[model samples]
Target: MTKILISIVGPTAIGKTALSIKLAQHFNTEIISADSRQFFKEMTVGTAVPSTEELNTTKHHFIQHISIKDNYSVGDFERDAISKIESIHKNNDIAIMVGGSGLYVKAVTKGLDHFPDVDKHIRTELNKRLINEGIETLQKQLKSLDFKAYQSIAIDNPQRIIRALEVCIGSGQPYSSFLTKTEKTRPFKVVTIGLSAVRSIIYDRINQRVDIMVNEGLIEEAKELLPNKHLNALNTVGYKELFNYFEGEWTLDFAISEIKKNTRRFAKRQLTWFKKDETIQWFDYTTDINNIINYLEKQS
Candidate 1:
C-alpha cells in the first residue's frame, strides 16, 4: 500500500480544524499541526487553537507542545514534523497535516536549505540595528538583495526581515538564492487539499472570528504572555495588538482594529504563497465532508 500524507491548508478561520478532524476520523489517523503560531503552549486562545472538545475528536501532534521562550525555527519544525509523520506512518498508512501557516507547510513538504548557522554576535547586532535604525532599513536591504522574497514576505514584519538578512550576511549569499527551485522529494506521497471560499466571505469570517476571539478571552491570553512579548511566538497578530494596547501605545479600539487588519493581510499573504503551488486541489468550504473524503479515497 502507498503511504499517504494529506495536507490541509488555507487562511485562518476558514474551517481548517473542523475539516481536518473529519478527515482524520475518516482516515483513522492523527493530525500534525503546521501552524507556526499554534505551537506555543502560552498562545492558546490568542492563537485560536482548537478547543478541548475539538481536540478530543481526534489526536493531534505539534499543537501547543512548546514554550514561547523556546528558540524554534522552520528547520526545527521540519526535522521534528518529519520524524512525527514517520512515527505516525509506522502504524497508520495515512497521516494528516493541517494548518494555515504557509511557510511551515512548505518547510515540511519541501525541505529547507541548510543555510549556514548565524552567529550570536551577528544576531545581537542585527537586533540592535532593528531597534535603533528601524526595520525599514533592513527591509530596504532585503529588497535590494532578494526582490522576490521581499515581494512575498510581510514587509511590516521586522523578524522576517531580520532573519532574511541574517541568512544573507551569514552565508554571503542572497537568501533567495537558497530557495532552490528544485523540489525536495518526500518518502511518502502527498495529497494537498485546500479549503477555499468566496474572498469576501473569507474576510468576513476572519473579522467575525477576531471579534469572537476577543470575546473568548484573547485579551486575557495576551495578558498572560505579555511579559514575554519579545518572544517570536508573541510577535503574532492577536498578541502583538494587545501588547501595544497594554503598553498604552494604542487604544483598545485601535488595537482590535489593527488585529483585524493584520489578520486579513496575513490571509492575503497565505493565499499568495499557497496559490503558487499548483499541486493543491481546492474545495469550497461549503462542500460536504463526504465529498472531500471520497476525493481522497479515490486518490488512495
Candidate 2:
C-alpha cells in the first residue's frame, strides 16, 4: 500500500497544531514536527509547543526532543524524520507533518541541498566578528557577497546570518549557489496543506499569542535560559527580546512589543517561503477540519 504524508504548514499562531491534531486523529497516525524553535526542551512556552492534552491526544515526534546545548541541523532532522516516517508507515499508511519552519519541512519532503564542509575556523571567525563588530557589519558583508541569500534569510537573527556568511566565505561561492534547484524524491506521496489569513488577522493572532506566552511565564523560562543566550538555539525572537529586557537593553514593555513585531515579521517570511511552492493547497485558518480530512482521504 502506498503511504501518504500530510504536511501542515502556516504562520505561527495560525492553528497549525490544532489542525495537525485533528488530522492525526482522523488518520489514527502520528505527527512529525518540523518546527526548529520547539526542538529545545527548555524553551517551551515561547515555542508554543502542543499542550500536554494535545500531546496525549496524538503521538508527536521531535517536539522538545533535544536540549539547547545539542547541535542539531536541518540535515540531521531530515535523516531522523525520514527514519521515523518509514517506521510509522510500517503500521499506518498516513502520517502528518506540521510546523511553521519552511526549511525543515522542505528538508524532509525534498532532500537537503549538498554543501561542501566548511573549515570550523571559518565559523569561529564569523562568530567572533558577530560579537566584536555587531551583526550589521556581517549583514552588510553578506549583502555584498550574496544578495539573494541575504534577502531570504532572517536578517535580525544573528545565527542565520552567520551561518549563511560562513558558507559563502568558506566555499568561495554564493551561498544560494549551493541550494540545489532539484528536490529529492520520497517514497510516500506528499500532500502539503497551508493555513493562512488576512494580514491584519495574522498580526492580531501573533500579538495575542505573545501575550499568552508572557502570561504563561515566558519571562521566567527565558530567564532560566538566559545564561545560555549565546547558544544558537536562543537566537530566536521571543527569547532574544526577553534577553534584551533582562540585560537592561530594552524595557520590558519594549521587549514585549519587539517580540510581537518580530514574530509578525517571521510569519510574513514564512508565508512568503511557502507561497513560492505551487504544490501546496492553501486554506483559511478557520477552514473546517473535515474538509481537509476529506481531501486527504481522497488522496489516499
Candidate 3:
C-alpha cells in the first residue's frame, strides 16, 4: 500500500483552511501548514491564522510553532515537515499538508536543491544598500542578474530581493540556478489540489479579509510585533504596511489600501508560482468540500 500526502494549495482568502480542515476531519489525520508567515507564534490575525475552533476541529502542526526572531527557511521546513509527515504516516496511511505558500509546499513535495550558505558580509552589505538605496535598487539589480527570478519574486520586496541577491553573489551564481531541475522521488504518493477563483472575486475577498483582520485587531497585532519589525517575518504583507504607518511614511488609510494592494499582488505571484506545477489538480473555489474528499479517497 502506498502512503499518501495530499497538498491543498491556493491563493489566500480562497478557503484553503476550511477545505483542509474538512479533509483532515474526514480522513482522521492531522494537517501541516505550509504557510511561511503564519509560522511565527506572534503573528495571528494579520497572518490570517486558522481560528481556535477550526484548529480544535482538526489537529494542525507547524502553525504558530516558530518565533519571528528565528531565521526559518525552506530547507528547514522541508526537513521538519518530512519528519513530521513520516511520523504521522506511521499511524495513518494518509496525511494532509495545506497552505498558500507554494515554495514551502514544493520544498517538501519535491526536494529542494541545497544552496550554499550565504556570506554574512555580502548579506550585511546588501542590507545596508537596501536600507540606504531602497527596494527599487535591489529590484533592478536582480532583474539585471536573474530576470526569471526577478519576474517571479515580488519586485517591491526589499528583503526577499536582498536575500536572493545575497545567495546569488555569495555563491557566484544566479539565485534561480539553485533550482537546477525538478527531480521527484518520494516513498509516499503525493497528490496536489489547487483552489482558484475569478480575479475580481479573489481581490474582493482579499480586501474584505483585510478589513476583517483590522476588526480582529491586526493593527494591534502589528503594533506588538513592531518592536521586532526588523525580523524577516515582519517583512510580510500586512505587517509591512502597518510598519509604514508607524513610521509616518503613510497614513492609516493609505497603509490599509497598500496592504490590500500588496496582498493582491502576492496572490498573483502565488498563482504564478503554483501554475508552474503540472501535478496540481485545480478546482473552482466553489467546489463542494465532499467532492474533494471523495476525489482524494478515490485516489488513495
Candidate 4:
C-alpha cells in the first residue's frame, strides 16, 4: 500500500486543528503537529493546543513533547517527524500532519536546504543586537545583505531575521543564495490542504481566539513563563506582549490588544509563506468535512 501524508495548513485560528482531527478519525490514523509553538510543554493556552476532548477524539504526536529550554530547530523536527511518519506508515497507509508553521511543514514534506554551519559568536552577537537595538536593526541588516530574503522571509519575526543575518554574515553570502530552490523527494506521497478566509474574516477570527485565550487564563500561562521570557521559545506573540505588560511597558488591556494585532500579523505572514507553494489545494474555512474527505479519497 502507498503511504499518503495529508498536511493540513492555514493561518492561526483558521480551524486547522478541528479539521485535522476529523481527517484523522476518518482515516483511522494519527496526527503529527508541525506547529512549532505547540511543541513546548510550558506553552499550552497561549499556543492554542488542542483540548483534552479533541485529543481523545484522535491521537496526536509532537504536542507539548519538548521543554521550552530544549534547543529544537526546524531541522530537528524534520528528522523526528520523518521517523514518526515512517513508524506510522508501517501500521497504516496514511498519516496526517497539521500545522500553521509553513516552514516546518515544508521541512517534513521536502527536506530543508543545507547551509554552512554558522559561527556561535555570530549568533550571540546578533542576539545582543536584537536585545539592544531592536528587530528593525536586524531587519535592515538583512535587507542590505540579502534583499531577496528581506522581501520573502517573515521580516517581523526577530528570530527569522537573526537567523538569516547570521547565515549571511557567517558565510559572507546572501542567505537566499543557500536555499536549494528545489524540493527533495520524500518516500511517501504528500497532499497539502490549505484553509483560508478573507483578510477581514481572518483578522476577526484571530481577535476572537485571542479573547478566548485570555478568558481561558492565557495571562496566567504567560505569567508562569515570564521568568523565561529571554528564552527564544518564549519570545513569541502571546507571551511577548504579556511580558511587556509585566514590565510596565504597556497596560494589560493594551497588551491584550497587541496580542490580537500581532497574531493577525502572524497569520498574514503564514498565509504569505504558504501561498508560495503551488501544490497546496485551498479550501474555505467553512468547507464541509465530507467534501474534504471525498477529495482525499479521490487522491488516494
Candidate 5:
C-alpha cells in the first residue's frame, strides 16, 4: 500500500485545525503542523496555537518546536517536516499535515523553487532600508521590481517582502520567475484538502477569532514578547497590531480593529494563492469530517 500524507489547508479560523485533529484520530496517526507562525514557542495566543486539549487529544509534531529568535527558513522546515513525516510513516500508513501557510505546504509537497545565492550585503542593505524608510518603501520597490511577487506574496510581511526584493535585485529577475510551475516528485501519495467559505463568512470568522484571541490574553502574550518584538516571527498580524498600541501609535480599540481588518486581508491573500492550485479538493467549512475522510479513502 502507498503511504499517504493528508495535508489540510485553508484560511485562518476556518476549521482546518478541527478537521486535522479529527482526521488524525480516525487514522490513528500523528500530525505535523505546517503553519509557520505556530512553529515559534514564544507565540501562542497570537498565532492561535492549538489548545492543550486539542494537542493532547493526539500526537503532534512541530508545534512550538523552535524559538522566534531562530532564523528558521522554509528550507529548514521542508527538511525537518519531511523527516518527521517519514518517521510517522514508519509506524502508520497515513500521516497528517495541516496549516494555513500555502508556501510552507508547497515547500513540503512540491519542493521550493531554486534561487541562486545572493550577496549578504544585499540583504543587509534591504533590512537597513526597511528600518530607515519603513516597510511601505520596500513594498513599493518590490511592486515596481516584481509585480507578480507583490501580488502573490504577503506584501504586509516585511520578511517576505525583503526576501523577494533581495532575489529580484540580486538576480536581475522577477522574484516570481523563480517559482517553477511543475510539481516535484515526493516519496508518498499527497492529497490536499482546502476548507473554504463565502467571503463574508470568512471575514466574520476571522473577526470572531481575533476577539477570542484577545479574550485569551493575546495582548498579554504580545506584551511578554514586546522586548524582542523586532524578531521576524512577531511581525505577524495580531502581535503587530498590539505592538502598535503598546508603542502609543494607536489606541487599544483602534489596534484591535486593525488586527481584525488585517486578519481578513490575510485570509483573502491565502485564498488568492490557494485558488491558483487546481489540485486542492475544496470543501465548505461546514462539511462533515466523515465526508472528507471518505473522500480520502477513495484517493488512497
Candidate 6:
C-alpha cells in the first residue's frame, strides 16, 4: 500500500482541527500540526491550541513542542515536519497534517522555494527603515521593485513586506523571481483538503473564537509573556494587541476588538494564499466527514 499524507488546511476558526482529529482517529494514525502559532509552549489560549481533551483524543506532534524564545523559522518547521511524516508513514499507510498556515503546508506537500543568500545588512537596513520611515516606505519600494509580490503578499504585514523588500534589494531582482514553481519529489503521495465557508460565516466564527480566547484567560497569558513581546513569535495578532493594552496604548476592550479584526484579516490572507493552489480538494466547512473519507479512499 502507498503511504499518503492527508493535509487539512483552511482559515482560522474554520474547523480544521476538529476534522484533522477525526480523520486521524479514523485512520488510526498520528497527526502533525503545521500551525506556526501553536508551536510555542508559552502561547496556548491566544493560539487556540487543541484543547487538552481534543489532544488526548489522538496523538499529535509539533503542538507546543518549542519555546517562544526559539527562533523557529518556516525552514526549520519544513525539515522537522518532513522527518515526522516519514516516521509516521513507516507504521501507517496514512497520516494527517493540519493547520491554517498555508506556507507550512506547501512546504511539506511541495517544497520551500530556494532563494539566494541575501546580505545580512539588507534586513537590518529594512528594519531600521521600517522603524524610522514606517512600513509605507518599504511597501512603496516593494511595489516599485516587485509589483506581483506587492499584489499577492499581505501588504499590511511588516514582516512579509520587509522580507520581500530585502530579497528584492539584496538580489537586485524581484522577490517573486526567486519562486521556483516546481514541486520536490516525495516518497509518499499528498492529498490536500481545504475547508471553506462564506465570508460572513468566517467572520462570525472568528469573532466568537476571539471571545472564547479572551474568556479563557488570553489576557493573562499575554501578561505572562509581556517581557518577551519583542520576540517574533509574540508579534502576532492576539498577543500584540494585548501587549499594546498593557503599554496603555489601548483599553482592554479595544484591544480585544483589535484581536477580532486582525484575526479576520489573517483569515482573509490565508484564503488568498490557499486559493492560488489548484490541487487542493475544497469542501464546505460543514461537509460531512464520510464524504471526505470516501473521496480520500477513492484517491488513495
TM-scores, all models, native as reference: 0.96, 0.98, 0.95, 0.98, 0.97, 0.95
Clashes of each: 0, 0, 0, 0, 0, 0
Best by lDDT: 4
Point out the higher-scoring one by TM-score: 4 or 6. 4
Cα-based lDDT for every prediction = 0.87, 0.91, 0.89, 0.93, 0.92, 0.91
Residue-by-residue lDDT tens digits, candidate 5, 10-97: 8999999999999999999999999999999988998989999999999989899999889899999999999999999899999999
TM-score of 6: 0.95
lDDT of 3 by residue, 1-300 (tens): 689999999899999999988888888999999998889899899989999999899889999998988878888999999999999999999999999887789888988866789769998888788777877888988989888889777667676798789888888889988877676687799999999999999999999999999999999989888899876678789998999999899999999999999999989988988999888999999998888878887887
lDDT of candidate 1 over 51-107, digit per residue (tens) = 999999999999999988888888889999999999999999999999987778988
Better candidate number, 3 or 5, judged by lDDT: 5
- Stretches of candidate 4 off by over 4 Å are none
- Provide C-alpha RMSD values for all models, in order: 1.4, 1.0, 1.5, 1.0, 1.1, 1.5
Candidate 6 local lDDT, 65-86, one digit each (tens): 9998887878899999999999
lDDT comparing candidate 3 with the true structure: 0.89
Residues 132-235 of candidate 4: C-alpha lDDT, one tens digit per residue:
89888898889899999999888877878988999999999999999986788888999999999999999999999999999999999999899898888988
**If both were scored by TM-score, which would come out higher, candidate 3 or candidate 4?**
4
| CA error at residue 157 for candidate 5, angstroms | 1.2
Q: Evaluate candidate 6 by giving its C-alpha RMSD to the native, one decimal.
A: 1.5
How far in Å is the alpha carbon of 113 misplaced in model 4? 0.9
Q: Which ten residues in a row have the lowest lDDT in candidate 6?
A: 126-135
